[model samples]
Target: MPLKKLTYLLLTCLFASLLTGAPAYGQRTKKTRAQLENEKKRNLEKIAETKKALENAQAQKEVTVGNIKAIKEQISSQEEQINLMEQDIDLIDMEMQDIVSAKEGLETKLQQLQKEYAAMLYSASKNSGKLNKLSFLFSASSFNELFMRYKYLQQYTENRKAQVIQMNKVAALLRERQSNLEGKRSDKKRILSAKVVETKNLEDLKTRQTAMVGELSKKETDLRTEIEASKRSVTRLDNLIANIVAREISRKNKERERLQDQEAKIAKNRPTKQPAKKSENLDGAETALGRSFGASRARLPWPVQRGFISDRFGVKEHPVLHGVLINNNGIDIQTPSNATVRAVYDGTVKDISEIPGLGKVVTIQHGEYFTVYANINQVFASVGQKIAAKETIGTAGVSSGATEINFQIWHNTERLNPESWLVPR
Candidate 1:
């Protein structure tokens, strides 16, 4: 029986250890509540931004295809917000479960401690008479036995005191765990309420998106006509860009030849036989500027502070028109009306012109590389003027009844995707 009791004790201790160890391990691996809350806050900010963009898009009197796109984007943001809220609710639920487990563990420990404390008190009560304790110590068989009895009494006294202290400690801990569990329950309730509201909002946004898409789908003919006009505008812009690039190239070549001829004349007047090195296509300042611009690839700032890419570069099927492809030389960013447009990098304003269908456009040169900002309502910088990165160069112009900017990056005559160059929105 003694052996069986010893085995049972060992098993009980092992079970308790595993129970306590599991939560400890989980606590080490799990994200804290603060971390989850911070992520949720950021997600809320993104939702707010998308809502603002949607409001701006709606402000336009005419309901164009862009308005539908804006609504779709707003719906996407609402869905993401709902997802984040769900994640937050899940985290709260996990926290509540953990709190419940902790409360249970504390209750178990407190019960065991109370039982041990009661047992100690009962044993002490049975030997409450001081005379009995003294006589029991004195009735030892030998001096050594008497000393052992005294030591045993002393140990017993200490054990009783320690048990009482441990009981109190466990009771306090159990109370703390109970309070924490209540708090967690309350938090779970609040999060669940929030989740319900967010889910409803998401559903409403989805319905609105469906309606917008449906309305736009009925105007396929008008959308197709708009697409055709946009295609023509893009073609005209491309032709103008090409002409500008050719002109710049021609002027650079002429400058290079002039420099080379001057160098040749100077070399002829020199008394040395060393040939002059070929003149560089760009001047020293321009070459340095180019190096700086090239080094900043994929790190350049957005042309507008607040916007989203409405159209991406390369070939894409028209959003509203079926069986139609639109080739985009640059990305189209949708922003608030009259949003300030800024330079992506430091450069000189090569030219500023108004294309018939493209609106006001400003082109800046960074050596061989050029960045063009189109669909500008107003130009702040002029031709041949030096501009710094993030400097306000113009205001975004309205297009298709929505504020939009067409941004392009070019290396000499070769057009590159502006999205690849600009920082992620």
Candidate 2:
């Protein structure tokens, strides 16, 4: 009966450790929430921007109706974000459920551990009585036998005490797990609310995109010099983002190295056991790249103030060449004959130069993100200079094939669709 109880005790411990061994996920989930919230905040900012852009988009009253399949992509992206958020909420729900279930089971586990500990202690105490003690030395007939029996009894006593201590420790752990479980349940509730909010916002985005398509369908689009100018701006922005992200990667590597060393040292004190598999590493280089680009989203400001979007974002039939379609990463905001372009956000100026066909351009780096305001007649900012939000950086000029301000967003050399970010005008 005692052996059966001990086997059950060992099995219970093994099961509990397996269930609880995952490194704390709460902090990682919090970071994910922060990133997603940042994305949502940026997305909402885009809503305000698109509203503003839609107001000015009215300038080009002419609209040409054709296939509008591209707007579907924007809608899809928004839906995807919403879907991902929903999945996150679902995962949180499951995790919390497990924690809660574990907690509910903990009271029984604690009672069992305590009872087993007491039983072990009581059994050891019984063996410690003088009558039992006498058997250790007296049961042996030879001197050598006596010493061996005594040593065996001493080891047996220590083993029993150790079992009691281990059981007591496990009981305390069960209580701690119970507290953590309750806290996780509360957190899951909040995430559920956030998921609902994101879902509604996604549906709203689709309606707005539909409206944009309807308004733009009347105009015949043209992309002459605009192509070259937009390309130059995008390249510059890409360079800036790459540089900034590279620096960030370097910094993160240093930090990881420091922490890993500490983890290695701490590992020595921990008992050998199977550790839980970690979820996706959001801190990895690939994930960071996504963050650097997609994370920038809609917080960025417009380059030209008081301009009509003479051209919308995406692929269009070349204005002059009817058979040819030109792919555009962004839109053209046509201002008065001479409009001074400004920095969209606080950042370090990375480039200030003129390209042959693109005219003047200025690029700025903001942490791991970058922005370019190009197709300028005059450049005012210098490389390596720190610039603030809305600071006048240059004067608009003819670049690529259009006389309009060309803007682009980049993160670590990857170009993100500025159409998703910039105010739609």
lDDT against the true structure, each candidate: 0.76, 0.60
The residue-by-residue lDDT of candidate 2 on 1-425, one tens digit each, is 45644545684565466356532455446777677667766654444444443343335343222112223333454565666567666766766765565555655665666676677667768877746678668978899989877776676566566666656665666667667767767776876787788678668767755665556434424333444564565565445446655776686688777667667766666668946333333356534544654554675567777554444667776543446576655566655557789887677786666655556767777656667676778788788898887899888885322346767666656666676775543
TM-score of each: 0.67, 0.44
Rate residue 322 of model 1 by lDDT: 62
- lDDT tens per residue, model 1, 1-425: 44324433543564456356535624752656567667667656556766776776566555676776666666666676777667767776776676677667767766776665576577678777545888998889999999988877776666666656655655666676677668867877887888789888888877877766677789887887877787888888887788888888888788888988887888788777766665555577887887888888789999988887777789977666667888889988888777999999999998898886689989999978899899999999988999999999989888876788999999888999888787654
Top candidate (lDDT)? 1
Q: Candidate 2: where are CA atoms >4 Å away?
A: 1-81, 97-122, 125-150, 201-374, 381-404, 407-425
Where does candidate 1 stray beyond 4 Å? 1-39, 49-61, 108-180, 217-219, 238-301, 312-315, 327-330, 365-370, 409-425
Give the distance in Å from residue 80's predicted Cα in candidate 1 to where it truly belongs.
1.3
- Summed backbone clashes in each candidate are 0, 16
